[model samples]
Target: MAEEGQVIACHDLRVWHGQIRKGYESNKLIVVYLTAPWCVPCKFMAPVVDELAKKFTNVMFLKVDVDVKQLKYVPIDFGVDCGVESMPTFVFLKNDVVLDKLVGADKVKLEQLTERHATIVVYFTASWYGPCKFMAPVVDELAKKFTNVVFVKVDVDELKSKAVDFGVDSMPTFIFLKGGDVVVKLVGADDKVKLERLTETHATL
Candidate 1:
């Protein structure tokens, strides 16, 4: 487990998997800091990453020392070959899917990317539900349109307990969250216009 507003160092493969799983299940963004002990640029960017972690409470920061023999196979489980040719690479992920990657130690770009991806929309739905299926494509389109906002699809059946936490009682529930707080919530399969309006409203906050 990681403390609030702190980076979680994954020295072991199991810990790495656990952290990513937890983040995916909770619909939170996972930022992986790929670094090695001897990398000078990585050393310089360490404090900046820590500061960003402190600022963005909702983002999960995982530090992986690539030199560690245990984690030599970094991101192999993500299904995508993350060819990290340089140190201090920042990889953004949601639901085990790689969203974006940044190479080198640029603090400004890192902070901007973090802020951009901070806005999240947690879409609660079930595969068997009709309304959920209907809204799936709409949500997918919105996700593509709003490149800055992260849209996470959570199946109620697979994660009933999580749905209960968010008080999701109906199919096709859209919960918009900025940082970690819920800013807006919509129920039912609303038309694309209404959903997009709410998404745009909260995403800019």
Candidate 2:
């Protein structure tokens, strides 16, 4: 809990599986840290996962305690199949599939896997527009809010061709792109709630 970024600890297996299902629908990468309250390596690795949560904003950071009450629900598909006998087992999942897994608290390989993962969010903007100026900080906060979405800024003046390609005629247009395609587009930044909800929608991959 001392860590920063959007890290959620679901002690309940049912709820955690729901979050995993959501990740599947969005096609975002799910990084699960299997830990226990008494495991020494799990304690040491907490800070590493926390830092990665901040570093890879395009990946969802989920912490699951193996010693939790819902042991029956925990080992069904992921844990049992992956042979998670050791503490601090790190699992990387994509498209409801287990892409890779690591045993023990090795942060090096985890970083490598994240660098080759999914999901990218790009923000298109122009430097001069008053609305864009007002929305800059708001969008940055949104980027921080969603760990699975990458928020990118594109100055229309600097990259006019890219702007034209995205059909961005206005000053401030928010485009949510995934798999190299536009999934959602919002024309204005007047409403912060709408901006946040829109980002939350596609933050998963």
Per-model RMSD to reference: 13.1, 7.0
Q: After superposition, how far is residue 17 of candidate 1 from its true place, in Å?
A: 0.7
| Alpha carbon deviation, residue 169, candidate 1 (Å) | 35
5-118 per-residue lDDT for model 2 (tens digits): 566687786779787787777566888887878888788889888887886656778888776767545644565442344777877888777888788777887777665554
User: Candidate 2: where are CA atoms >4 Å away?
Assistant: 1-4, 79-85, 120-205
Tell me the whole-model lDDT of each prediction, alpha carbons only: 0.81, 0.73
Model 1 earns a TM-score of: 0.57
Candidate 2 overall Cα lDDT vs. reference?
A: 0.73
Question: Candidate 1 on 131-202: residue-level lDDT in tens?
Answer: 888999899888766654667789988999989999999888998876467878899985768999987776
Clashing pairs in 1: none
**Which has the greatest lDDT?**
1
Give residue 145's error in model 2 in angstroms: 13
